[model samples]
Target: MPVARSTKAQSIKQPRAGKAPSVTENVPPEKEEGCQAKRSPSSPQGGPKKRSAFGDITNAHKNQAVTGKKEGVKAPTRKATRPPPALVVAKNNEINLKKSLRKTPPTDVPVEPEKDSVSEEPVQQVPVVEDIDKEQLGDPYASAEYAKEIFDYMREREEKFLLPDYMEKQPDISRDMRAILVDWMVEVQENFELNHETLYLAVKLVDHYLVEVVSMRDKLQLIGSTAVLIASKFEERCPPCVDDFLYICDDAYKREELIAMETSILRTLNFDINIPIPYRFLRRFAKCARASMETLTLARFLCEMTLQEYDYARERPSKLAASSLLLALTMKNLGGWTPTLEYYSGYCAQDLHPLVKRLNFLLTYQPCDKLKAVRTKYSHRVFFEVAKTTPMDMMKLEEKLKS
Candidate 1:
């Protein structure tokens, strides 16, 4: 019984030694040194041919060399590697399909009507003559010459009611000086990016009010500036302050004086403030006549020249506008002002025949030497006036004004 037990123990020990040889041969290079110190090599093929449990190729053969047991080792053999041709063909087909899809045509969709339509309605005609009376149309003020009569009456009033007293009072500044001031003020307004209409209306208001309100005893410059201040506030969103107004005037007037003048001017005009200025009319008519800037400037000078004439007090704003435009047309050599423009003027004022006749008379009327006294005596506010020394070229003006 003791001998049988000894043989069983030896059998177990023999197999254990053989297993150690195989494990040492298959160990990786990293583990070979430690593994060799504990076990001997079995066979070289043991490292190369042995398949791991996970079937991965590792440094098993390298370990055999490190252990000095590589003479019997064989190189690792792997299954032949190839991708299936069907898979490659399917990938190419997918790419071609994407390319062909990009070029496919889009479908057109049909649109439906949004709403149903209703039946058409018949036209209606209303009478205008029945509403207006014939007697009203035939009144003297309603006649074609009504506008001319109004202008004539205004001229008479200006000469009779406005000019005599104005002429009697001694002028503080010469006509030439006033004209220079006017020109300079215009330049300043433009430089300051101020409203041209405000400046113009201010000038017009000063002229209109001065004809009746203040005497030549009062400072005209103060009146002009006062008008400008009032006009600026009325026409501009941001009017220049009183200091700025005085600064532009070279501090000629006090701050209190300007404010006082402004109040006085407003009161004189009855606070109506909506005085129609020649500058506004000039631009409108210049556009209508399609006149160039030079022509416009000359016409404006002529219109402004009228402000110095006391005779314009009674002159209708429209007549002044029409006459200035016609005179400018003559100066510019533009033959025959547009009838359409005339019609437009008539339409704007709600009266046509007066402007049409005014345009005709202004085009045909000849200026005479008899008016030289009138021209020389009248104080023009826009250009330099010379001393009474020589006669004007009435002949040239006559020929031009006639045409």
Candidate 2:
């Protein structure tokens, strides 16, 4: 029984098959002492492959050789033995994607620099005009932010209200008759203390209405009076009532007639009585030019006189206003139109010369016999008697434009 027990103990202690052989087991005794002093060689592949001290999930370490060192010193580590990713050699001249991802610069390999896909050019910047309204940023009533936008909008609206020589088409009324009607409207505007805008809009309404409707001569006064009433309602804070308009016309138009005429004008114009008048444009351009009250009044007088002339009706309101201001500036000898005026008014001195010539000619030569309302109105001290001021001479204006 003792002999059997000794054999059983020896069997239990013996090395099992397929287990990794000890490093000293295969190494000769002579080198076993120096193995630990230098890098240890892994066991030969003919023997069982070495298992990792730190286990791997992929079991990749099972196929690799590991040194029998206690610490991984000077031997290829588990990281170095990683499959396929260890040293990914590029097959051809092409770079391995993995190697490029590492951002490793090429060693002695000559590579041509990539060409740019598009050619580059320096952009020529446009010269920016100075903003005239920037100085008025502090004044809220001046509406400095939207001032440019507002004038531009009015200029755009001017195209819609442009008229031809409707007088040629009117058999019942002549241009002189239309002038007489507008001259009377100016008087009514003064007597009623209506705004200058009201007078301009009233005249616009009359002209636009006349273009569409052919009325008898008897209805001309009715049309003019009704136009005033419509303009008054649109522009006045306390607009004169229908009875007042009838009273002003000496009751020539009945209350029903005035109301009907108003409806007819509104409908004919599609309720578009919001015509862009020269008065508004004149005021804006005068402000932009920073003209004095006397100079502005002179411009206003010149513009108002043009209202009676049938020839000027076809002109754009903005251009008319700008030309009036330029003529006033010339007459006042305040220097020709400046860059600021040109910027805001959208008119060069050259563009205004022709219109300015005609406007100047009208004031200097137009007779004031029965059509004396505008002349008489401006002759008052309240208007600085600008009507008495001499219009700029034609030859001198030509010289000014030439400059």
- For model 2, how many clashes? 0
lDDT of 1: 0.50
List candidate 1 segments past 4 Å from native: 1-184, 215-218, 305-314, 346-403
State the lDDT at 255 in candidate 1: 89
How well is each residue in 1-403 modelled by candidate 2, as lDDT tens digits? Answer: 9999986555433322112333214434454444232222232221121122112211232233222122232333322222222112112102332344246343211121111111111112222346778898999899999989998998999999999778777888988888999999999999999999999999999999988888878899999999998998899999998888888889887888888888889999999888999999898888777789999999999999999998899999999999999889888878878777778888878898889999988988995577999999999999999999977678988898787
Residue 26 lDDT in candidate 1: 38
Give the distance in Å from residue 38's predicted Cα in candidate 2 to where it truly belongs.
66
Tens digit per residue, CA lDDT, model 1, 290-340: 677666765655565454344453465655666666655654567544554
> Candidate 1 at residue 280, lDDT?
62
Each model's C-alpha lDDT?
Answer: 0.50, 0.74
lDDT of 2 at 227: 92
